[model samples]
Target: MFPTLHIAEKTTGSRGSLALLRWALVVIFLWFGCMKFTSYEAMGIAPLMQNSPIMSWIPAVFGVQGASYFIGTAELVTAAALIIGTFNKMASAFGATMSCLVYAVTLTFFLSTPGVAEPTAGGFPAISAGTGQFLLKDLVLLAASACLLLASIRPADA
Candidate 1:
């Protein structure tokens, strides 16, 4: 479990940790987005994209490979915005919104992607250890993105 945050303390550790989280998200987005430029990444996501009603138009508009590039570009740009947000409030707001959008969109794949859930001895909502785990992990990213968004959108103290 993570340590409890004391907002009133305004400790160096707290601010540093928050900053580090932002940097980590930026790096992860950049790395994953870069992978989309490759054939393997494109192919790997083909089924998920095809199955997703929201994303079905991607292949028609950008083609399978091109869609990957488009997503990759989005990722890189979002990462850049987050990096800029480190210094500017407007930039942080933009980056935070973008990051949150990305997380929300991807999280929807829980509905579109098959094998995400499997029949288990327990019940109807059992999650697959593989694909299910992968999609569920995005919750943390969503929370982190939300944190950034809240920090950026709130009015500065007088």
Candidate 2:
């Protein structure tokens, strides 16, 4: 019924989409991870870390600057493993798992951080530009990470 559409779909398949997603994740991790080394980024994230019950220990133990560095290192490592995973299935699974965990923690910022909801907008569904909007993207990243994880763990023969 849709010969041209089917032909186009077959020509440019799921592999392209998967590669795009993987590369996009790598870029995000690398860019954000590199930024974490800077003082401004460290200072910016201080409020979120300080407010988080689960992440509060990071700033308390490592200090603001040190915490950023630690997180940055983890992000860089995840990006590296993902890149290497192109060839190695084990690396891919590990990277996907790490990405999942990272996004899960960041997603909590919506609940833990103050001023996430715009008071003038009546709060709740209205997310503030400062922290709320920024963290919202993590929802997509978390989904991508989960998809990668499932793809990585599936039997090779299948």
Candidate 3:
């Protein structure tokens, strides 16, 4: 149970937390985007992505680099919009759509790949069970994004 605090509606704490979350999301997006650009070769995900039937159209246009750039730009723009707080609703909506797309692509890849196990580090077994696990996690993230988008659009009167 949480402690009850009869605080004023105008308290800075709630607003500050919201700001923190916004910035945190921005940092996460920037980090992932940078990773996609910088570590393309080592990641080995590009081939899987290219082979994915769901992403077949992606390789035709930008190839791996172009796809990476496009995804990176989306993340960067979403982060910027959220941080600026000028277009929070639109940004969140876009982010939710992006998350859903990612989830779908990853899920399709997992389903197509057989015996695709996560790589082990040192002597320890990998944490993820493979693409299926990745899909499951991404789905949860998609749900979270959807919730954020919904909350952004919710009517105050309701």
Best by lDDT: 2
What is the alpha-carbon lDDT for the whole of candidate 3?
0.58
Q: Can you give the TM-score per candidate against the true fold?
A: 0.87, 0.90, 0.63
lDDT of each: 0.86, 0.89, 0.58
Which ten residues in a row are the worst by lDDT in model 3? 119-128
> Could you give candidate 3's per-residue lDDT for residues 51-118 as a string of tens digits?
67776676578777777776667666666655554255666556645645655566677555544445
Per residue, candidate 1 scores C-alpha lDDT tens digits across 1-158 of 99997677342235576698799999999999999999999998888788888887997799999999998999999999999999998999899899999889888988889888876745338888887888898889988888888788777761
Ranking by TM-score: 2, 1, 3
- Per-residue alpha-carbon lDDT of candidate 2 for residues 30-140, written as tens digits (9 for 90 to 100): 999999999999999999899999899998999999999999999999999999988888998999999999999999988999988998899989989878899998999
For each candidate, how many residue pairs have backbone atoms clashing (under 3 Å)?
0, 0, 0
User: How many clashes in candidate 1?
Assistant: 0
Ranking by lDDT: 2, 1, 3
Count of backbone collisions in candidate 2: 0
Greater TM-score among 1 and 3 belongs to: 1
What is the Cα-based TM-score of model 2? 0.90
